[model samples]
Target: MIRRSRWVACAGPFLFPWGEAGSRRVYGLVASLAAAGYDVVVAGGGPEPLTTTALPGIDGPGSVSHIGLSEKPPPDAGPLASSIQTLLRWGQRTVRWLDAQPTRPSHVLVHGGQAQYMFHLQRWCRRNRVPLIVDVVDWFNGRHVRGGYLGPLHASMKLALHHYYPRCDGIIAISSYLENHYRRTDKPILRVPPTLDVKNLTVDARQTVDDSSPLRLVYAGNPHGNRKDLLGTVIEAVGHIQREGASVELRVYGPTLDDVRHLFDGRPLPDGVRCLGRLPQAQVAGALQEADFSVLVRRPERAADAGFSTKFCESLASGTPVIANLTSDMGRYLRPNLEGLVCRDHSLAEVTEAFRTAARLSGAQRSLMRQAARSQALESFDYRAYAEPLGSFFRNWD
Candidate 1:
């Protein structure tokens, strides 16, 4: 029997195998590490049961432990308070759990957390002489907070980041924007973006475009306050395209029709627009494979600059091109007319023109673009490619 290395991954409070992009990234990392012959224990807080079926591709599901810290808090608690309390409890339980293990972990990997709890974890790791690698997935500053009521909380969190990030043993950034922002003394900073299990994503060889068939466009994600304006802009742009006599159909998943209506202030949906409620991963993958293009946009803000979109990677892996605005490090990977169309200003006219350009592409051109999209995924976003680098990094800590 092969002796496997053990690792403990501390992620935020989320049900395993959920639709949230950050949770999916954590799952992918755990599964990849397990596949690479590491015994990974995912510790977090959630009510959902974590079963073998929840982790489909992982080997020895019994070896991978799921340690739940506490039940999710009710909605009455403010967002900042809830996050702080959850991380506090999770950090406490995680330290106790580590003490009970027969052997200490080779290293500890923390995905995201509150500043105080993360600092506490850092101190514990230092005392135990264990390597602690922090993954920076988002800017934890005030940009994510919607109203001005949480200004003080956001400011304190920002202060925490200033003190917390520089003390970690190593840092893993998800985008160039974050890489540039969090460059403290010469610690090992790896740019590991959102990764996809490319082997599982079945690529369609058949062309999605048919001159006679209406252009099929798909968008899947939640409509948070930060994302609402961009989503509304896309919807209005779709309406413009339809009115110009373009046979385009936009199918939106992850938000109900009523939700979208509410975003539009109860305005009726235009023709060729359909809102399908949240879907399972398998169904969303199928929709992407069958669509001509996927649409994504982010406004110019600190929050937008700090992270990359996982939907963009999924779309490309499904052999579908994208129509996205240039934000963060997205331009580094996607090129206009090669992988997909890009909107420069994200203005209504620019987005509408992008849709028109995509609609005008010939069948052969679209097929090549789809191939390029898949190639990009295989080259840059595959999770298997990350395993070796991450494993080597942990091993060298000794």
Candidate 2:
């Protein structure tokens, strides 16, 4: 049997663009392990093995080592091509790449979606007797979660995942909802919410902005599926605000804006509507600073219900107030009268009224609400709290 060591983590295809929360969380997890005196080796998919961390060529002040997987199939390749390539070439390349590493991990951390490729890695770790820890962020049946492509084969893949989960040393669920669902399997699982690096982030004073203006609203997230409904609500609400002769402006950031514009099909955004496209993470805080409130208007669905999006936490940390629709997990965390306003219905009038009320609040009043949002971020969603529990979860495998 292989002896235990103090290393953990397996880098997934989701490594680059470290600006995103999930990517950053993965890096943070490895970095935290390194800080705890564990030797960390992150094997991931990229153009090449990363010589530095995800700050685009620059490494952070962390002890973790990163290796990006270069030989994997390009992301844009269609299904059959990618599958053939992964099965024929990428798996061997990944194994060979891990073999070339100077050290192996005592505990392996594997994220979902990539579970199909993991059997090979699992078998390899079994031969080495390394303990495996799998983290599941979404329901295996929920293909729409995180924009996972769900073709006909998705069902079979999910079945494979169900079988795979029981063999792991431990499992991580990011929400109580997910934990409850997975409990049916009788596996050892932990529900740790998506956490933010709250120390590096601070609740900045709501910058001296034109509060007299109609509420400036910002929405950020992928623009697909039911996300379209949320965007439509924002647009209609902004129209109502304008009809009321208020100076409301709505700014959107994400890949879905272009598709939305196509849906508009040449109808111009009256005046205050702007599609900012997807901005870099560094610029998002500034964008948030400029806005009166952030928006997360997800529709009621299994996927949205089970997972809490990172956008919710980041907006709070940036000191931007949020205006979320009453659906999914919003009711659980955000009180309707406190923290921020929750539109309990899909009516455009209700959403517009909330925007108007946000506009009417005094600077101090809004600041208090923003503070409440930030406090929630620090106390519950901060990464530091999850680190010890998660680290111990891995360590117990010894």
Candidate 3:
């Protein structure tokens, strides 16, 4: 399977290889697409000036040419000047690949960035006869910045602009909600939830859960940006069970202790809850692999449906079942008594009951679930699983 096609991606708002959740998704996409044989190039917004780097490849057999695009403006640059500068960067870097490279890009996939930049990119792709695919991952309506009076209005406008799909040729949705939101459109849609490297997926690190040791639960992600509102509820539920003498421990993995403390309004965390603070990805993976379950129980809301939980897939990758509720298209993938357990909802009563359910599971039963989780990761979340499908999907655009 050889492909001469080149696919360039715009890594909006995220720095390649090092940014948060969105960056990892872009990395996975690049890896999968490259394995599919396309020459994948990623242009990411960074605080620094536009330049190429010697970063190692996540793109399996191939290497990704990473060009850092400065998202930050010069201190004295006006908005108009900044926008013009950005347009020039795109035109010079992505659009003019034909001048310096042997082949023009067949597709331009946007993870997202500034609205002005996206609008221009869309128009150019249309004029140049290139397919423009928007990766619709999140739709949180909160104001993205701390701007003064116009913050709300600006945020709303940005949010709305991202959802305006009339100009887009295709969509790579992170959830069913996002995919279906644009289902009426004539554009092609591909639902790709949080995916990771699965080549070395091994559940052997997780052994039988012992009744003597605590039933460990891990949560890894932004504490507030994603409205990890249910984290407090999870803490309380675990506290309640601990009071009842259940052996359990909840681990918080993303935010620093100070940040977590501030988010909880200076309130104390419940017993059996440990704020491990922002940890290295390796440590987070180690914790997840050792845990009985990873947690992602958000309340049912539009924000919840707008995107999938990357941590949920991470849990599966670590062979850890999740104590989660259905949001996005998560319910479809979770098997209640198998790879993962889903809560009916994210309320206190339901969350408490979910904890009890885990408490009741025997060591062997939990081991079976862990094995199921590893299988699920290998079957569904592996980058390789999407390589052929994405190849076929992009090939059809021609």
Candidate 4:
């Protein structure tokens, strides 16, 4: 029998069963790798896990193991200091673990732009000759920095990232826009789409939504000021839709709902607008089942939005048509007329017209769109398809 000798270390923010963008992608990839028989270790966060409970039928000798922040740092440190210390500790632990292991990994996959982790992992891999693959799903310098104190931190991280990219064996970027954005690195950059967990899709047709209610338009995502402010235009557009007697309600779900809710500032909604705070990922599909469509209007303010939004795939998975304003790199992957509508500008008229067009589609037509959405998702966005290339890369890394 082949001894399970290959050990792969995958690290990211802690993600449970239900996860956000980074968490979802990292967890899905790690699970797949574990099932394929490579001993895998996942190290990340400990604070606000969406699902702290373990997932049934997923345990194994080499299944998901969360590395907690508390294991390294004093539990009471401020968030920023705590994160830095966590990185230092995580780096130290990972190096020690790698050094003491009986068999070294063929490859190491590092996610995100944690500078300390990247530098330490690369240095150790170089010394030990383990190929390191870095996935740049989002960029730090050009995109992630938002307004406020976080901006400077992000700027510093970007500098570190620029300095670290050349040291990796390979890089996996999620979008072509990002691939081209970092062309100066002169390293092999693989453009991969964000993976969709279609298994979570509970509804296949848009008709599952209650038609009696005003056209249910929903936006499920972070409500932070940088990306969340786009909801303002959504409200303005929904107001226009309501003026046309198209009963419309906006449902905002995700961690940043408070940011979005505060944007309202007691300004009366036209009528049906409601804000449902962060809902579990398991609950999103059922909610999407009850809604007519999903909305994401990213203001061109940060690079985070310039990349891709997880809600984009989630919207497609729910078989709900998406109405988006900013045309980021995602525009390259979306199918026209079959999946949903993409607006050139965030004009009230544009949103109103898009809704009218959606209202005109027959049930069968909507079902066709839903199927197309799923097909596109499975072919382009699912993680399963990516395993071969990624696995082959590691398998051949001698």
Candidate 5:
């Protein structure tokens, strides 16, 4: 039986209902916490505060209270002056919100990005005897240039890594790479992937394939920052197979043909690849459901391993197997032939061979792969599956 627990307050990172990766990740996490029997109240950066909002993509099968941290602009202030004032306001408001809680939180999960947020939460947790867990999503150590406009922000984040995280009672990481990077002997850590709603990703398994039709492979992200997906290598491999008369078509999303050309430094996309303009999230789900496979190859690097891929998990959930190369902890889950083709490395030859195998999958084989993909998504990415694990992770502290 799941033991009912006190509240887990998530503070300052993703904007609830709609934010980027951080928002999406926190949604899955709090939902899992709720499933594990912890009452969760999440705060996001939004235009206004709400008592409750629709749980995005995953949750407690209902809404949760949300607090917005967007402060009124410091009018008549210069750039530096305005930033300082705005940040101060956000910090003050965050502490006030936390203090205003009906009861003190039993546990707190806060992203370690904003120092003002961290300092206040640390003080609060220390005072209340509540455990504070740092949500370690992205590491800024290697990704940035360290000399640009983001220099100070980057330094601040790095300082948090060396200072705040090590002092925290526990670490909740998004990948094995991050878990390992932030792991300490004194603290416990759990690695969770960016999760999705398995029901939304459900696609009817295809019973038959038209032999004459080209194999459809969807690449649904901007190529500008591939996180080492090796877009050039992926396109080249597909183009080579096309030149050999293989019947395969690549649909590129999130970038128009012109945008593609511009992003690729005036280079044209290979003949077999078609640039499909960006679509709404719901529309993208439809596109993923219709595809034979999704291309998710990434090179071995800190950027690739440090963060898990939300797109990859979504594809599997949509019953579209990924033509993936193991970079992060993907090797932990990807079952070759059962899920999708796996490349041994990022070389052109290896990628070409992976594509060649994908093109050769028979209709029945594709159907089985589709079923297996969804099954993996449910087992690996769904929040419900992690309830027990999350429960255990916290129970030890008590």
Candidate 6:
């Protein structure tokens, strides 16, 4: 009998049952690691805490377990206070949980970029002679700076990044831009971009494209203030296409109908445009499958450029071609006219033209594009393959 290597993952206070992009990424990595014969324990959940649920669809291979924290942060607490409380609580619970284990984890994977818990975890790892790895999933500093809500908290987190991250044993970056930003001369760094479980997410048989049906385009994600530019661009482009008398419809999920109306400056949605509101992950997958194309347009800001959208992979996994702007590492992954269309600019005219190009494709051509999308997903973005790099890194670490 072989003793499986044990690992612990700590993602402070943000765990979910499913549907969230970030949580899904973490779950995918952990599940893949378990599938590869590691004994894995994921410590997560706060605020709205999670109950002990079976790791989604994971069974009969390697061992995987979840330890959900029941302590919830106060709703009235400020951002810094809430984060600090959550971190402190998680650290305490983690230490107790570790003490109960027969042996300490070989490595500790910290998911978030900046956390007070990381400092505590680092000290713990140091005392135990265990490797501590930080996965920088997004540019948290850029987001805080752009968001303008937590000034002092952002300053402290920036300091923490410079101070604690360098001391970590390894770093996992989600994009090339992030890898460059967090590069440390003494630490081992791996660029593992966001990936999806293509095998599970993809449709078994490609659906036949009906030429007579309207050219359906779908966009799903929060339409928050920072994301206004992309959502606005897509809305205007859809309006432009409608004015041209094109048989097209842009269905948007994630944002409420009232929010979508507000985004269009209180005016009515353009012809053939509908706000479908938020949908479950399964429903979003269904929407992607039913659509001819999916849209993701982001401005070339530092925050946007440093992070790759998980939706890009999810869209392709659903066998729907993407119409995305050249932001982040999207251009590096998506080949124009192969997996999807990449817009050179984020202007309405450019996105509108891209839509027109996709709309113009014949049924056979569209089917080919869908096949290309799924092929690209399986080739590059499969979660199992995505986990191999990190697995090797973990195993090779002395």
Where does candidate 3 stray beyond 4 Å?
A: 1-5, 10-13, 47-62, 73-102, 143-164, 201-206, 262-265
**Lowest-sum lDDT 10-residue window in model 1:** 53-62
lDDT of 2 by residue, 1-398 (tens): 11235556565655553575566656545645554455566666667545534322112332455676764568688979877765545345566765665666677777643445666667777887777777666554344544355553365346545677667767777667767877887767877666656666644565344456567788877756444346776777777778877777888887555565664554666578888778888787778766778977766666666666777767877767788876545566677656689887767777888887887877667767777777777777666666566666666776
Off by over 4 Å in 5: 1-5, 54-63, 71-78, 85-90, 112-116, 141-150, 225-228, 396-398
In candidate 2, stretches whose alpha carbon ends up further than 4 angstroms from where it belongs are 1-4, 35-37, 50-62, 75-80, 87-91, 140-153, 206-211, 225-229, 256-258, 326-328, 346-349
C-alpha lDDT values of all predictions: 0.73, 0.65, 0.71, 0.63, 0.73, 0.73
**Candidate 4 lDDT tens digits, 152-185:** 4475467556777656887777666667766667
Tens-digit lDDT string for candidate 3 (1-398)? 11356556554635555457777788677777777776666766654443443333344455456765555456688978865665444334434433344655788887765455566667667777888878878765443344533664355346434554545888888888878877878788888887777765444564666756668888888756436546777877887888888988888887777776665567887776788777786566777886889988786888678878878887888888988888888777788989878889888889999999898888889999988888888898888788787777787787
TM-score of each: 0.88, 0.85, 0.85, 0.83, 0.87, 0.89
Q: Name the lDDT of candidate 1.
A: 0.73
Residues 1-398, candidate 1, lDDT per residue (tens digit)?
11244655554544354456767787666665666556666666554444433455444322455666553465687977776665455366557766666777877887665565576678778988888887777776454563343774465456556777767888878888878876755777777888867866777768546667778888898867425337777888888988889888989888888888877677888788899888987777888987889998777777677877888888988888899888778888899898899998767888899988887888778888999999898888777777777666666674
| Residue clash pairs of candidate 5 | none
CA error at residue 198 for candidate 4, angstroms: 1.9
After superposition on all C-alphas, the RMSD of every candidate to the true structure, in Å, is 3.4, 4.0, 4.0, 4.2, 3.7, 3.2
State the lDDT of candidate 6 residue by residue for 45-92, as single tens digits: 553333343554443365655666543365777978766665455466
Per-residue lDDT for 242 in model 6?
Answer: 76
Global Cα lDDT for candidate 4? 0.63
**Collision count of model 6:** 0
Ten contiguous residues with the weakest lDDT in model 2? 53-62
Q: Counting only residues 3 or more apart in sequence or on different chains, how many pairs clash (N, Cα, C under 3 Å) in candidate 5?
A: 0
